[model samples]
Target chain A: MAQTLILEGNEGYVLSEILKLSDAQHPTGYLSNEEYTKYFLKSVKGVSNVRKTLAQQINDPTITNVGIIVDANSKGTKARFDSIKSTLTQYLPTVENWDYVASSPAGWVADVAPSFRVGLWVMPNNKDDGYFEHFLTELIAPEDESFLAAQEMLTSIQKSKNQRFPDLRAQKALLALFLAIQEEPGMSAVTALRKGLLRHKHPAARLFVDWYENTFTLG
Target chain B: MIEHLTIKNFLAFPELEVPELKLINLVAGKNGVGKTALLEAIQLYKCSDKIGTNRLISENRKGNIIHHKDRIFASKLEINNLSMTMAVGDYKSKVFIDGEQVEGHGHPDDYPNHEYEFIRSGIKEHDWISRRWSSFVLTEKEELVTEVISKVIGLNIFRIAVTDQSIMVKIAGAKNPVNIKSLGDGLMRTFQIAMALVDSKPLASNLIGLLLIDEIETHLHHSVIRKLWKIIFEYAIKWNIQVVATTHSQDAIRQLFYEAAANESYQEKVQVLRLQIGRSGKHEVIEYPYEKLEFMMDTKLEIRGL
Candidate 1:
């Protein structure tokens, strides 16, 4: 059986690392906007492209499970989740007769027709208006005291008029600075996770791991 | 255009339904999944000469001239408000208009006059190509075909002439006209496909033409498939013809998608249908409209079935 995890950007590397940390088998396939450069889904003309992708995946007989991961951004977790739900509702084959109810916390898993499951998770703990970087920031190991320093520096920068980054990019700037000071400096989020720089047992991390396990239970 | 098709007891398909067929539909599936059978079903349904169609289908399959056991072929087609259903068996054949059965095993006069051309895979017979060429020579359609060959295959052709034994093309600056067969298999296949499309012109302005091609990528190079599809799309729209083609080549599907997506008006006129045999021993169809096809091509997903 083929299972896929679709991400909005190049977050597959980080998600792959997290799956390893959780001692879970990685999904059979991964799709992200990075691979779709010509028809990127982020563009206005490509807004409904995700729905189109979902329609094809849902019809594939080999695919038994699918997981969608996208940022909440300014839309908030509820709006993002609702948008995904709408897409699913519109594209799911009418023959499947899929009936979905939101799961606890901020994720959903539905048993569709012909023996397949679909799951959706909004980023940043699935409750706040943030992105993958915000979720990554929450995984900073408690013993890493430099994280607090990074946060303070970012807060000061936000208050200053000279701040170059937009308010929406605060989490990304903080994570970058924090990673810059690590022992293996300038490593990507995935490499940092591999080196045990981020705590896998954090509460936010546990919620996501639980969602993944429940969504893709193997035979 | 035939918007939907239903088949029962036709070839290997016990029961199947395909919906939302567009102007240009590409059918893809694994071997024995009945890609060619689907084309035969459409041809059998549209052909007014049922006896001749049955003989052609049987000859194409190389099946026995006479069946030892009874086999039934039934189909239901929907186009706009018109609905047609036909069931052909060993003993008798029946055709229905809307829901009422026509009298006397359904005469050819009872059916709408729609032109049909079913082109099989591989090199076509020389006589068939010559005959198709004979119909279009010295007509406006002949110039259209010549221009398409010139633009797509980069061949400078002054005219196309049919000899007693072979069809020949007069290339510019050439001493003698060369035989079309000597121009290589790609050009010959392109010539056959182009002729099939042009020959399927409807006799009446209100009638529609149907062109069913099997394994359209048989002798086409990857580089030429895109240009060939461009010609197909242009001709299909210009002539008000509906095209249903089968292909196993990923390049064929990709190029078709790119060509369709490049034009705004052609975007909605293309679709891909995937046929698969379900675990229940029944055939199933999955449709990928323009948007879904675009997404699959963009993400490099496997649109061809296993």
Candidate 2:
């Protein structure tokens, strides 16, 4: 019973770390944009490439479940979810209840075809206009004073005339600064999670963990 | 070309419905999924001599010609406007066309006289290739075949001659004609495929031809297969032949897509049909059109039903 989790960019590494912290059973397969650039889902060609990947996975009898995790970005949750549903419907026209499932904030998981179940999760709680960096930010230890310092540093930089980072990239820049001050400086966000610098039991993290476990039946 | 095909109670397929076929189609599936059986059904459908076709199909599997009464093979060709249902039972085989029983082995007056050639797996026997070579020599197709084989195998073939005992080929520097088999299995396989493709061309321009090749990648290197596909695609269009081949090699599938993608017109002419067994214990087909296939190939996705 092979279960695959497909992610965009370096999200696979982040999700791998999250799975390790949650003590949840990992999926059988993990695909990222690093390996399949089409998983970036940045353009029409990317989405078409992803549709082909989904078709291959759905037709595979060995794969029991497939999950896709993409950022909401500026499109928000509904539009992102709709895009995935549309791509899936092109291959599986008989699947129903997509709109009903899209109504939920927790994301959707159901058997779209015989012996084939698919799961979709738009990042940042699936109801907000943010990305993976925003999701990782929520897992920061609330009591950690350094986290507050990092936020202040980013705010002061933004207010300064010489600030180079754009407002849209503030969350990403904040995460980078937070990781830079860790015991292992210049490490990736996923490495920070691996070193226990981020709180895995945070409510936001638990919410995503719950959606993941239920979607893939990690129990 | 057969636009659509439906099979019922055929070998291994209780019921199967294939989507619209293209100029060149590659059928892929796991073992025992009936890729070969699909080709046999098409051969049976196009055969004018039912008894001979039934015996030949049985011989290919090394089985007896007699079959159970309930083991009836039925198929319908949508665009060709033909339907054939036959049962090679212990007593006698019966055939029907569009629900009308035909006497003896003769097809109906309206039956389309389409030509079909079934190339089974492995190399053809010396006599078989020799017989086909004799017929090919009678036509003006020898130079075309020699040139294609030369290009595919990287050998500068000057001429090809068939003797009573063996087939011989002369290279550019060869003092005398060498046995074709001396070149290796790749060369022989290429020659057989080229001959089949050229031989399938009908004398009448209006008549369409079908060429079924099982295990098309047999005895061929990955590089050689790509070159062979280029020629196949070219001849498929020029000769008005619809090619259907089965393969278990991923290289074969990938090369077919690459060759088709290299030519815009060939892109629409190619498709891949993956046969699978559904939860309901029935065989099903998943068609990958040219666009989808191109995407799968570009993403390096597995399309062999693995």
Candidate 3:
């Protein structure tokens, strides 16, 4: 049977990028189907708009495993993780705590009626705060001059204004400007990942890639 | 109440199972997705009247009934542990309960007599309802009919008169009482269902068990669909009847979801069953609980997967 994966947003850009990498890394049987059913990569969209259905998705009998991808955002990594854990523990009361240091990363895997596995990864590394953009910013090479220049320029402009915005907002401004220089300027992180603007070989990218494979592909 | 259904090689279904069936089930799917076929399968199970082997085969066949394909198909319905399994093979068909042949009510010596009715869409000469209504107006049951119609249409039916040749009915707004047919197809559809519920309610010897309907909201306006669903839902609960109906109306689904969520008592009784293409490229049925369906409605996701 094919498994279902739930994502945090309605937009498909980020998911498409993740799929591109997962397919390339593990092309064999990454997606499977039955004789009469065409089971592709299943992903449930989530947000405040679809929050009411999250419990249903978690408890649906047909799903074998549920992979949740959300941004840690202002809530911070561990807090966001705990928020999900608190909401979902009612369904899978025995869900294990998040363990980030493990080779595959720790997931709240549950084996109960409609039994299935659960895996969650907060964007930009489950251990850090900020949104997915912060994680994408980690892809910038340490010696890349243009990106360093953009950061310097953003800091100078803000410093000249008495630094009206916090450091997090300033970093986001720098990232958006840096991404705008690419062929598809101002595109989403998934779009950047798809166009090879975001280096897949970066260590930060590898951490998420490892968590995804270990949770979904590995036994 | 019927709680579950399992099908194997029956009609359009090669292998399909609905593990969770609620009291008021609203089934939605795209065309050719077996929405009608699901009802037909239920009709077959509720066939208390005897059917010829050849006739049954031809009725369920896709193209030529004699064409070469798997000739055996089965459907099983469960109400608690008391289950009924009906299997058709080639030109022969049989009904079994606990692995034993059953010659249920109706037919005296042969045939199964299940207490259920399957109302199909399209214009049909509803002379039977008129004849029943004519006599029903003279008895104490007239008020019951009026109550059902009032609940469904949201207007009191002032008078019901029966003549030797026709039945005359008057609603709250109409000036002149007219023949039942004058009210139009939509009103007729509502009357048919209301009457069915009244007649099928627990009687001296029978308690209505199931109702199989094809496009239960056909010929009805969106506003009327909402009211009609309320009437049907009320009767279903009061009479202890399990309703299995198909519909292509999103309005009907939204109304169902709204009512089910708003009413605590209905939360466990109303369910939306979606038939869509699974990953295997064949039809698969999924149940959307009341809360989930409401979420889908709020998100504007096409419930039918169109």
- State the lDDT of candidate 1 residue by residue for A52-121, as single tens digits: 5666666666667777777778877667666666766665544343333443454766775556787777
TM-score of chain B of 3: 0.76
Worst 10 residues of 3 chain A by lDDT: A32-41
- Report the Cα interface RMSD of each model, rounded to 1 decimal: 6.0, 5.3, 9.2
Q: Candidate 2 at residue B236, lDDT?
A: 77
| DockQ scores of the candidates | 0.16, 0.26, 0.07
Native-to-model Cα distance after best TM-score fit, residue B210 in candidate 2, in Å: 2.0
Per model, the share of native interface contacts recovered reads 0.05, 0.10, 0.00
Q: How do all models score by TM-score?
A: 0.76, 0.79, 0.58
- Comparison by DockQ, 1 against 3, better one: 1
* lDDT tens per residue, model 3, B1-306: 445666555555666777767878888876666787777666655553345323344544435222113433233222113233433221233455334454222221221233566666654454666576765676656778778877777768876776666667887788988887677677778777776666656553334456777787788888888887787788888876778888877777887776676678888788889876553445677788777776666544445352
**Which 10-residue span in candidate 1 chain A carries the lowest summed lDDT?**
A38-47
Output the TM-score of candidate 2.
Answer: 0.79
State the lDDT at A132 in candidate 1: 83
Error of 3 at A58 (Å): 13
lDDT of 1 by residue, B1-306 (tens): 566677665565656788567889999877667888788777756654446555654566663131212533223222113223433221234554334443222233222443477888888777877787887888988987888887678878888888878778899889899988788888888887877777776665655677899998888887788998998898888877889999887778888888988898998899888887642335788887888777676676667354
List clash counts for every candidate, in order.
Answer: 0, 0, 13
TM-score of 3: 0.58
